[model samples]
Target chain A: MSSIDIAYIESDANPKVKRWKRLALEPRAVKRERATLLEGLHLLSVVLEHPKAEIAALILSEEAVSEAHELVEKLAERTGARVYGLTKRLYDQISPVENGAGCMCEMAIPAAAAPEDWREADVLYLDGVQDAGNVGTLIRTAVAAGFATIAANVGTASIWSPKVLRAGMGAHLAAHFVENLSPETFREHYRGRIYAADARGGRDLFAAPDYADGPCAWVMGAEGPGVSEAAIAVCDARYYIPIESSVESLNVGAAAAVCLFDARRRRLLKHG
Target chain B: MSSIDIAYIESDANPKVKRWKRLALEPRAVKRERATLLEGLHLLSVVLEHPKAEIAALILSEEAVSEAHELVEKLAERTGARVYGLTKRLYDQISPVENGAGCMCEMAIPAAAAPEDWREADVLYLDGVQDAGNVGTLIRTAVAAGFATIAANVGTASIWSPKVLRAGMGAHLAAHFVENLSPETFREHYRGRIYAADARGGRDLFAAPDYADGPCAWVMGAEGPGVSEAAIAVCDARYYIPIESSVESLNVGAAAAVCLFDARRRRLLKHG
Candidate 1:
């Protein structure tokens, strides 16, 4: 506690405060800084334990400084990051969620280089998925199901966006993510089976024979149009989750969970 | 179009406007009136197709009436539901979303009676899942996986709340829901096997032998504390999704999807 230095910020106009507000609200700021804001102590604690984490600052609401004083001191000491205590109003301005845990941090987004050959990578590919919650949930689900890499096309939402990060529930700290990818690039580099999540026509996912336990990519698309034409052009086949014929389709997040965990289940049954 | 009468309501203080506003914002009003509001044309279209649907009114923004006039007229005629054209400002007041389709309706809550015996039922029991989105996604996933019944414990978020309804994406119209059930009642009435979604420890879900294709229930709980004690008391077994050991847990919605869909997969494999 004695070693932790806490800077108290009273004004929204302070340079640090303004920059943080921008980082929280504006994607451009996050890109320029190569960092993003992670709200809540839960995310902060997860990031601190990641081997590659580089935390720039920890911001705590004035109330949190008192309510979570011991834990805050421990986190500050562990990361040796600068700590700022903000007025509740100022903190609220930087947090997108209403009535959130009054703690957040700015963490340097780890630069994960894509493998020169994606032929042997088990990947989750996002094609034009723009919902932050969906993208975040997919990341979390992919990690849970043992996907090591995630590649998103240019039009997908930023994986590090605040809302996505919140939805990710700390799984962001575990996976290697590559964004701004193109379908042409995916087709050229990935020499493995690629299965698009097709809603309209495909082999029934549960009844289909399992793909060999090797490198594969599960391509998921936006909710409306589903897997894009470009993405479909690269797929070895398309698979559709079986649902009630009257229901429209499974939500993308739910579909991903069903697909990925089924993949895991297959792997477990075969090996164990 | 000639068969439909579109009433224009401009005043926010009109008694009709006030009552509809209360219905949209207050759960008490919804329960009292025995109806809930469904926003967007997609939901309206689905409810119109259901045989039991009784729409009280269809409210549309001025913009939507023009943008979707033909479809609106077709829907109104199909259901013979009263239509009201609201100013964008007033329409936005009733719709919880931003930049929505601007079509909404108050539909009567369909009456569904509990089955005489749960021994032959496949159900999804939500045990104190307080997040509206999680509850909704669970409903959608369960319905997709062919679950016919949903029962939630008393402390779970209201299954029919606007947020939950919006998240359900029309699944609410497809399934029978029984909310505010006590675990004791569930234990007494339901003589089937119940599996709780446990994050901590349980049979590795994928490796566990399948339950026979008969009456069964999957119990899903809140994210933080997992399943409630009461819900656990009624569960014959606990199942946990396998994930990366470093990761904490899967989101409740994702967990439910994995569990329910796996159940579907087992059934498909057995029958096909």
Candidate 2:
């Protein structure tokens, strides 16, 4: 193991502190640097488990180091990552959660493959779903349902944003993510049957027996506008989750959970 | 219709403003007054549609009045609700959403039915589900799935709170809500097959063909602790949603969606 020499940062104005704050708050900075910030111990632990995860820096508050000295030390030893300690006040400035775990990691963003290079995978395509929490919950739901990949179009929330990351609850580590793709590019490059989720004018999802035992993609639209005309045109079929007419529609996140898990249920019944 | 005399309040210290603020922010005030605040145009429209809805006061920003004069006038005419206008600054203080709809309503909290008084109804029992957003989402999901009643234990978030009201997206209008009931009382009074949602040690929900075509209750627990032992003990059975082993579990709201919709799907199939 490399010699343990931890740098201590005391000021919010420090360059490292500035960079961390930018990464936590600004999506552009994350994209520009090709790095994302993982906050709290749960996310850090998940990132560590991934074989491709590359830790650029490991930052801990003084309190975090005091509270979890052994775990922090072991992580640093295992990854040989450069470690930095921040004063409590400085740490609070960069922490996104109200009661943060006081540990954060700056890690390289995972590379995305071109549509042409996409492998046979169960993919979730998010089109214009802008709510960060919804996006994150969908990602978590996707992972739980055994989806292998997530591809989000331009209007969707950045998958690496801090809000989405927190909502994802470490599910990002288990799935491949591709972002900022256009509908045209996605259709041209992806080699899968695409099913669009629509509220009206679609077959009942529960009764639809056409979900083949092969690679497929489920395209979800934005909260209100739903999938664009262009995106809808490329889909192989449209499916709707039945609901009571008294309510207008289900929340996108809830809708995603029902659909994704239903697909999983079908697969298990067919394969098992 | 009574002559429209919209009283305008400019000062934050005004009694009406103080009361609205209290109703919006303080749970104790809401419970004491047996009233809750509804914000925005969509909620107001939904509340207006309920024949039993009693609007004690209607508060709108001057901008809202100007922007939606016809709708506001119609609501006042229909409900005969006393209308008050607030300065933009005063309205912003009480508005929960970032883009305040500039309208608010103070309405009676719907009376809850005793467990014995509940008719043949599909019920959702929430035990210690404290997150406001989660509580609201579950209520919406329940309504969409044709559940007729919601019973939340003491530790659950207040069903009438502003945050929950907003997240519910008008589902509250269609469902009877009971709160502060203990597991013992709930079991003694409720008449339905009780199924607890468990992450482990339960029949596969998708494969469980035993869901009788009758009134049933799905008991969901808090985000972290899952269902309490007391709650679980009273349940007739436990059902689990099958998911991948890589992730820990689905979010409570998401889990509710999958389970509730599955029940609905089954009912539709049986009846269709």
Candidate 3:
């Protein structure tokens, strides 16, 4: 690789600093197609695997360069990204959440077509899942369990939010995001069975058709009030994740993991 | 049944308030043999399921009593415990955390015995998992997966922290806790083959030993930095939960669900 072009950002007012500030703090930066942010080397590796991920530039606190010596060298070799170093104070001002990891890269929103078969694959519809971390983790598990896509309701956290990006670890590149889903509209677009994961349910999870059998839709609600009654009433089934005698319910994030992987295991056994 | 002898608490400065305040913000409140706090009718239901859990006094906010009339009445009719109603404003002041469900009961912490045959079951060993929410959720999942007897290291969250209590959704009653374990100590007490849930050098979780055959313990670490190096060194084996193509890791709470359940499913098939 040619000698890396290094730039220094000494003030929060610097154009690069302002850009990263939104990347860290504002959800619209990612949602509005202005920019998306990825932090840490592991996540960057995930971006590299996505053939179309348009990584715009690398940004780091000066202290981060020393802390992430190997990563700095490697990003230069791999992405040909111009590394801009911000002073520690400037970095702190630009960080969106309290503990922003040392390394982040500004990326342009990739032009992606919605998966054509979103309605056919076993899928997850996030209805007002406000917590960024929960939304992200759900996407990651959905992917692991072989769900083809995620459809988000209007009030759900933006797919590009930093907390979600960090918690998701890096599922954004692999998973598809379809926004603006109301219960009535979503039902019309899909032909398969629909099940809402709610506490009060008609069946145990094991009783549901094995996920490998065919297309199914699994809907999860918000953390507090859970899926709206209108959504639950419309579902063909509501299955409970049979908790042990002592637990009232699993955390929504944990619940999704149990349900998603259960789907995956069923498929693996059927196919293998 | 005779009408219950209930007390009304209209004053904010009541001695009962002072007593619960200690349990509210303090971790030691539950550890000390004096008193513990339990909230919500769902939680109280979990407590009453165990005969050993002595119900001292029930605290219900007036607003909740009016709103959750059926639930409050059910709890009152079911137990010998006295119910006290406090006005909404006073209840807000006594609330341990923000926007609570408005039900708190003083109950006795039970003395739990280790399962006689933990060595033959799927198990989870938590090492210094400091976040109470994470710790509680882990225990809940371990129990949900049908594993018994989870122990915590000294550095981890107390098994009864309020955040964890809420997160576990009432799992503390069933889970067995062992305090302050070193790797050497864990080795001495547990006969199971220990598996460290590590990303590096770990076997694929989807292909691990069947949980039904013999003793197995899955050890998990704090967020960010995985398990401690010392703990990692003692693992008889290491295994990782497979994520999607780009995701690096799932949330620790979610990860526990995937691990515990995967092991449980394999074990179930083997035993059946």
Return the TM-score for each candidate structure. 0.96, 0.96, 0.77
Two-chain DockQ for each candidate model:
0.80, 0.81, 0.45
The C-alpha RMSD in Å for every predicted model, in order, reads 1.8, 2.3, 5.1
C-alpha RMSD between model 2 and the true structure: 2.3
| Distance from true location, Cα of B47 in model 1, Å | 1.6
Stretches of candidate 2 above 4 Å error? Answer: A1-5, A65-68, A116-119, B1-3, B65-67
Question: Candidate 2: which docking quality band?
Answer: high
Could you tell me the fnat of model 3? 0.61
Model 3: residue A271 alpha-carbon error in angstroms? 2.8
Please write out the lDDT profile of model 2 over residues A156-248, one tens digit for every residue.
Answer: 988988888889988988888888887787778777788888987689988888585688888899877887888899899999998998888
Global lDDT of model 1: 0.83
Q: Report how far off residue B239 is in candidate 2 (Å).
A: 1.7
CAPRI level of candidate 1: medium
Model 1 pairs in collision: none
How far in Å is the alpha carbon of A3 misplaced in model 2?
11
Taking chain A by itself, what TM-score does each prediction score? 0.95, 0.94, 0.88
Per-residue lDDT tens digits for candidate 3, residues A112-159, read: 335455767678888888988778888887877778588877888987
Worst 10 residues of 1 chain A by lDDT: A63-72
Q: Please, what are the lDDT tens digits per residue for candidate 3 over residues B49-108? A: 766677787777766744344555556666667788778777676565556677777876
Which residue segments of model 1 deviate by more than 4 Å?
A1-3, A65-67, A117-119, B1-3, B65-67, B117-119
